[model samples]
Target: MDRVDLLPPPADAVAHRADAYAAAPLLNSLLREVAERLPEPGDRPVYRLPGGRLLRVRGERRPAEPEVRTAGGWRRVNHTELVKLVAEELTRHTGLSNHDLPAEMLDSRDAVAALLAARDRATAPGDPYLRSEQCLVTGHPHHPAPKARGGGPVAAWLPYAPEAHARFPLVLLGLREDAVVEEGDTAALDALGDAPPGYRLLPAHPWQLDLVSCAAAFEDGRLIRLGTTPFDVWPTAAIRTVYAPANDLFLKFSLDVRITNDIRRLWRHDLLKLRRTDEAVASAFAASPGGAVWLSDRGYRTAGFAFEELAVLVRDGLRDHVRPGATPLLAAALVEGFEGSPLDTLEDPAAWWEAYLRAVVPPVLAAFADHGVVLEAHLQNTLVAVTDDGMPVQALFRDAEGVKLLADVPRAQGWERLVYCLVVNHLWEIAAALAERRPGFEPWPAARRELARHDLPEIRALLTSPTLPGKTNLLLRWTGADGAAARYLPLPNPLAGA
Candidate 1:
């Protein structure tokens, strides 16, 4: 690997990452729902925006090398130019100007450049699964500014970045028993390290501690440092969550950074509702027809004062849920196109896709239809385990915080969220990735069949729906809504025809 120095990356490296970072979401929003296609299609399909502005991109699934029409033919749009173009397009189309989003759009591109530079220099993890977990350079393919890392310095977040294939020891802190506030089963935290008689062991994300100011508390002896973990923990696709393979533990920490929709902190409200939501979904999977597994968020531990900042959730790891021989891979990594992704190397794409859908789809749909549990079964939260032949045999889901009970949302709203997450976000991306690699194999027919087998009324409506609810990430950010607050626009549903 060509190592980029810690100081500064070369200009070309900067441009490449920036272009990739900016082009993806801009292309995604345009191609998926916005752009008007030119009559003839070629190697590079040209799209027309409102007011007759022309846009062209390199590829379909993960669009790259964006270009726009200028007075002199087509001109390549850099990250900055693309952001301006997006802003202009959105303004013209929506009749609104979001000044903040344009800056964030630029920041996102710059963040990608930093990640790329770091990856170039750093030695990526050798383990295929870890590698897959770390591979998310594109990130939230539909979002305008997916890689924007809090608009912080490269040094601030790079060490903990999964995209950079970073693995480091957790900063172990000893919090006074009286000061530590926790609920549910957080016994797993105690096993990480020992503490004095008056203190409890609390492992923290080193990067998080740096970002949050707690020097006063540390100086006053409320919190004590007990040194870093003896061994490194592999950062999963979710940058805040790390997997300690030695202990078979998944540790999720509160990150104030805006990842996708929200500032990905383990919020108190979510924590309060966690057990209920997790239990309902877990029960559904346990009783469901398929042998799908729910990697439960057993419990959480945090400092009394720094509730969200210092919070860390303990989760069950792959050992308990995954089959003995089958290897677990992040579904997001599969869609994002990782090194060992089954989608990439599939010899029989159709059969593999069928197995994938069979393993993943039933449990998600069943959880909603039978158990009144709405799981955020997006790519990041879903894990599909493959056999020796890379055939998906089991689907394991995680993240209780994202779960919503039917009691919380009405039936229609819950169904809409389910369809969006499952069909649009998760399944659509997988099918697209599968098609991208294996050209002839169409994944939607199998997906349609999978939905057809299920007797849910929503499933029937889903089959015939002209357009699926596509989340408007760019507009969401532009309008400055809460990240989890989803706003949808209709996209031509592949399931309608296939």
Candidate 2:
């Protein structure tokens, strides 16, 4: 398959594209959360909003060009109007008002416009892996404000944005030996740059450094600037995490800005429990069958004075886990569509999907059933390594910070979280993307078969269940719920009949 030539569109074209991209997720959330589906027989599904307004949109997977039924007739809703409608409806539905979320929705749209413009000026990386890592334009396709950058100015966040195909050198710092707080194996930091005799080297994400205030520490000689890395690091889909091709290393840093749900900061509580969660996940993957790998979050380095702000996590790179001759691509990027996607030219989608299932499904299920480890196997956290023929050969799972152990949480709760992340967020999107490409392709039957192959207690119920848990991002954000606190609403289960 040949890579698509992404020529720069006109300013108006870019704005139009940005509007569609931004509105899709917001419409999806509104339809799923606060709106009731009305019995309409047309290609476009009509929904009754909370305040009795009728709304409709084209397509299902990526809903676009939303329209509202006014007194006169059907009227188109732009990104701005959509955000306003969503806010008003949510207020009526929830009987609560939130000023921040509405602002975030607008900010998200603006961010998309900025990203599109920046991408027009930037050159996408040639490496398939890097391209996949950086190719999430309409991120978290169900969130109302997926791309919102904490309402920061375009100049503030554009340089670090993954959607903009950004790659920049890491800002290196030297923390005084006494103020340096680290755990596990963070030896990779030392290799990036050398520190003075009394200081320990710490690599920082440039954007994060800009967001945080470490001037006091610098002035007191507790921290010192050691310049930037010689080699540039490619920002992955997770903007805070950068991949250094030279060392085959991944460094996850703390960025205070919120991208999707929560602020992209390495909180102290999570960092403290990181090793335990990572080790459990590693153990599960090690004992599991096949080549499915867990990219371990090795350790972290930070200044004791600013633990969360200064923290940087060292992750095991792709070179060791990825199969020989197989290229690893971000699973999310596959759904978002990229230059070198296997879905673009699949001779046999069923076989390709089966290979994908073989690589992705079993490990996640086994981790939950056999090892009592619930991996957050969402799209962003997964990598599908494919052969030269574009068939999936392996699945690499990462991000220990999101992993939950059944020992800590109730078994049922862990299972629900697992189901939401693996089945709903990950598999459903892939299945939808595939079915979109090949009309009449029933992805659910194969999904059902693969799922039924497992003997877990929940397997039977999962297959027969009328609905699956779909996280209510819109409602959650509207209610000002904790980002980590996942609240789910039932969504029609395709696997039930399949």
Best by lDDT: 2
For 435-498, candidate 2 gives per-residue lDDT tens digits of 9889999999999999999999999999999999999999999999988889999999999988
Error of 2 at 357 (Å): 0.7
Candidate 2's C-alpha runs over 4 A off are 1-11
For every model shown, what is its TM-score relative to the native structure?
0.94, 0.98
* Model 1 Cα lDDT, one tens digit per residue, 272-382: 777777778778888866678999898888899899899999999888778889998888888767667676567898899899999998888888888999989999999
Q: How well does candidate 2 score on lDDT at residue 222?
A: 96
Q: What global local distance difference test value does model 2 have?
A: 0.91
Clashes of 2: 0
Give lDDT for model 1: 0.84
